[model samples]
Target chain A: MLSYLINGISLGSVYAIIALGYTMVYGIAKMLNFAHGDVIMIGGYMAFCSSSYLGWPPIICVLFSIVVCTVLGIIIEKLAYKPLRAASSLAVLITAIGVSYFLQNAALLIWSSNPKAFPNLINLPSLQIGGTQISAVALITIAACIVIMIVLTLFTNKTKMGKAMRAVSEDKGAAQLMGINVNGTISLTFAIGSGLAAIAGVLLCTAYPTLMPTTGAMPGIKAFTAAVFGGIGSIPGAMIGGILLGIIEIFAKAYISTQLSDAIVFAVLIIVLIVKPTGLLGKKIAEKV
Target chain B: MSSILSVTDLNVHYGSIHALKGITFEVKEGEIVTLIGANGAGKSTTLNTISGLLKPTSGKVELLGESLMGCPAHKIVEKGMALCPEGRRVFSQLSVRENLEMGAYTRPSSEIEDSLSMVYEQFPRLKERSKQTAGTLSGGEQQMLAMGRALMSKPSLMMLDEPSMGLAPILVEQIFDIIKSLNKAGTTILLVEQNAQMALSIANRAYVLETGKIVISGTGEELLCDEAVRKAYLGG
Candidate 1:
């Protein structure tokens, strides 16, 4: 039971971190930002390239990966979303899918399809807690996730630029008139969210130790589920949702067949949606232009 | 006073609908100007175009003697024209205080507190509900918050659209009174309203629009007493 709890917490922490990026972007841009998951994959590859291939230090590799992934996010925004700002949401959605496919295929070409290992990063010593073996890396992932979430929450609620994002999310025109550079705010949002995803990617690589082109898809879908499971646009909602999802998955794996893990997680989501379509923390909004 | 905002031969379209057709007008500083028209008279479109939400198909919009053509919405804002958009588009999830703080996002970060205090003084109810989410506010309170948020940006000229819309009769009076006071406090205002009587009462001058065309322009009292305006707008 304790082992299951530890594993659940470790996995959920990653989802919580990645889910926040999804939730924050969705809250402000009202776009699903499907490219978010792919950015994580890119981050993993960047780390692999920097640390193992180039013999760089681990911390420097992680930092470099974050910066590289942030730049990729900005470029994606400029190339795909910005030009199509006035286009229909469907157009942007298709564009995002294209971006995802393009990046995955490109990674396949560049990094090869085979899994690459980060042996040093993966060897986190196991610690016994409550008669259960929990590795230091898992605890580290959870702590890092908590710290990032706190920083992001503070930035959004207490800072000037964050106010601009909330304002634009509320009403774009009014925000523009208030002298906020709307485009700049959007770019900043992409940067922050993608940056968080990169950090998650590095941490995820530490736990799983292997990377390939398609690794981000499962985590992406899972984080997205976590985001919607909480509340699509609510920050705290995503956090709680992520942790809940982790616990459920762990329990399902422990108590039932491992094959039913995905099924159980999604079944819970469907039940929640049927009970409250808006998710646990999501507040229903009144209609307006 | 010299023209602070000048629109000449302005034409706007949403896919060839021709919302504003060759419209022309000007606003001077330190004056309360009203633009009154019936529904679909292009009043809101005019304001939207000037605020850079929509680009005029062809024409000129100048602010402070500078051409405002081919500018994005934020650039127009940086030029010191803040819009309190129609329907009071407040940041619903944020507190009233946060909404107002967002208004000064382009200004120095240190200046937000002072701006919030100023807006709070203008609408004490807003100050009272400073911590309340804007979505929970009544329509009147929302309007106050919207206007307050615009003021937070410290724009030299403020454009207000339908400030009296959907408010109770008493709240309508309070909104107009606040508009008058805001103008008195040194914010130049360009108001668009369907309620010509209330608007003219507070306006220094007024323009009458009908289907994208300017039908009349005069001092507020002069237009208020006009027989045609009285029958069509003021309801005799």
Candidate 2:
């Protein structure tokens, strides 16, 4: 039971990180950013190529993954979303779906459909606590998620750019009038969210031990579900939602049946939606005339 | 003295409907210039175009003899201009201090403390609730926060759009007093208001806008006594 819970938490941490990318982008830019999940696939592929082809160390590979994703995020914003900023939400949503399919096909063309075994970075033995063994990778993942959450919280609260982000999220015209480089602030937000996706991609591949073009598609949808499960725009909500979803999946798989786990996870989402439309932490914002 | 802002043949359009048509005005240094007109007279449109929020169809805006064409709103602000928009658009999710910090977004980090102190001194209510979210503030308090937030940028020229809107009579009096003091402290102001009485009384010069055209322009006292202006705007 303890091992299942630990593994659940570690798995949930990756989802939480990916969900953060979705939530932050949505909060600041007010777009769903459907391609966010595919960014994880790209990040994982970059890390794999760096390690296998370039023979780079783990630290450099991680840094390279983050850098490439950050740049990709900015380019995606400039090319795909920026032009449609003034267009209807439906138009932007369609464009985002287009971007997602574009990324998937591009990966299919580049890397093919075969799954690759990910290199094991951490080889430490499992830690035995109360007769329950926890893998070293699980411990590292949970620790990294907690640390990243803290850093993100501090960055948004105690930084100038963070305040500008909040201000822009509140009112773009007013933020521009206040001398905030609204475009630059938005670009920075995409970069930060994409950078976090890189870490999530790495941690996810570590636990799953397999890589493919379609690997991130399920997790991406699940993380987005996690984002919605916890209030869509709230940060801590994503973390809680991801962990709960993970634990529920594990418990359902262990006690009930593995085949019904995904269905059960999604069913829980429906119940939460019916009970609270704004997720758990979301507050209804009245439209100003 | 010399003019700080000059607008010539400014025209603005909202799709097919022309909002501001060939309006011309200038605000000299050390002056409070007010644009008073009835609703839909394109008062707010003029300010928006000048501040780079709206694109003008055709016009020339010069600030200190430099054309303000094609400048983004943020760059216009960094050039020592700030707009306190209508209806007090404060960042409701953020704390009072954070909202004010966003105002000084273009200033150096080393000088933020000074700007915060300056704004807090002007609006003690904001200081008392510096840690509180702006959405929770009362209408009067939010208006003060909006004005205080604009002042945090320490703009040389401040433009206010309907500052007295949605405020109580006493608060209106108090806000006009703050405008007076802001002018005395060396900040040039361009004001747009439907409350012609209050707007004209405080302004050094006032322009009467009618259907996007400037019909009359003079010192504040001159417009107060003008028969057409008094009968149309003032509840005469």
Candidate 3:
């Protein structure tokens, strides 16, 4: 049971990281970059190429993936999303879907459909705690998630650029009036979010040990689900939502059935939405007269 | 004093609707200039166009002899003009202090502490509620926060739109007093208000906008005593 709990937390950490990307973009840009998951897939491939082909160290491989995805995210935003700024939400969402497909097909062409074995980036020995053996990756994943959350919270609260982001998220026109470069801020958000996606991709593939063109799809959907479950736009909410989702999925697989776990996880989301429509931490936007 | 901001033959359109049609006005350094009009008279539209939030269909806007046409809103702010928008559009989720910090975004980081202290001194109520979320503040406090936020940029020419809207009569007087004091301290003021009496009382010069056109312009005292102005707007 303890082993399963640790494994669950490890998986949840990846979702938490990815969900941060989704929640942040939704919060600031007010658009869901559904292609976000594909960015993760691209990040994983970048890491794989660096580690296996170039024989680079693990840290360098991780940094390379982050840089590539950050640049890719900015390019995608400039090419695909920027033009749709004034368009309707429905139009933006459709464009996002188009971008997602474009990325998937692009990856298929470059990397082929064959799955690659993901190298274990963290080679630390397993730790034994309370009569249970926990893998180093699991421990690292949890620690990394906590650190990312703290760093992000501080960045938003303590830095000028972060405060500008929050201001833009609240009111674009007011933020602009304050001399904030609204476009630049949005681009930065995409950059940060995609960079985080790279970390999530590396962690995810390290745990599952598989890399393929479609590898990011399931996890992306689950992380997005976790984002919504936590009250879509709230940062702390994403962490809580992601961890809860991981535990629920693990327990459902253990006590129920592995085949039913995904179904049960989604069922739980539906119930949460019905009970609290805004997710766990989402504040109900009150309209002031 | 030289003209701090000059708008000549300015026109604006909201799609098919002509919002501001060939209106011209100039605000001099160290003077309170008010634009007074009834609802849907393009008062807010005029301010928005000048601030670069809305593009003008035609006309020239100059700030300190520099043409402001085609400048983005943020760039315009860097050029020393700030607009305290209508509806007190404070960042509701942000703390009052954070909202103030956003106002100083155009200024140097070294000057932020000084600007913050200045704004806090101007609106002591805001200082008291600095840590509170802006959304929780009452309407009057929100108005003060908006004004204080604009002041954080340390703008040379500050434009305020409907600052007294929805405020209690006593709060309206208090707000006007702050505006008066701010102008006295050397900030040029361009004010838009439906409260014609209060607006003109503090305005050195005033323009009356009607259906997107400026129908009357004069010294505040002259307009206040004019039979036509008293009959139409001052409730003769």
Kindly give the number of clashing pairs for every candidate. 0, 0, 0
Clashing residue pairs, backbone N/CA/C < 3 A, model 3: none
Angstrom error at residue A216, model 3: 1.0
Candidate 3 at B70: error in angstroms?
Answer: 1.3
lDDT (Cα atoms) of all candidates against the true structure: 0.87, 0.91, 0.94
lDDT of 3: 0.94
Q: Model 1, stretches more than 4 Å misplaced?
A: A122-124, A286-289
Best-performing candidate as measured by DockQ? 3
Query: Who wins the lDDT comparison?
Result: 3
DockQ per candidate, 2 decimals: 0.64, 0.67, 0.71
* lDDT tens digits, residue span B44-80, model 1: 9999999888888899999999998888888887778
**Rank ordering of all candidates by lDDT, starting from the highest:** 3, 2, 1
| Residues A128-208, model 3: lDDT tens digits | 899999999999999999999999999999999999999999999999999999999999999999999999999999999
RMSD of each: 1.8, 1.4, 1.2
lDDT of 3 at B43: 94
Provide the lDDT at B195 for model 2: 88
DockQ of prediction 3: 0.71
TM-score of chain B of each: 0.98, 0.99, 0.99
**For model 2, which pairs clash?**
none
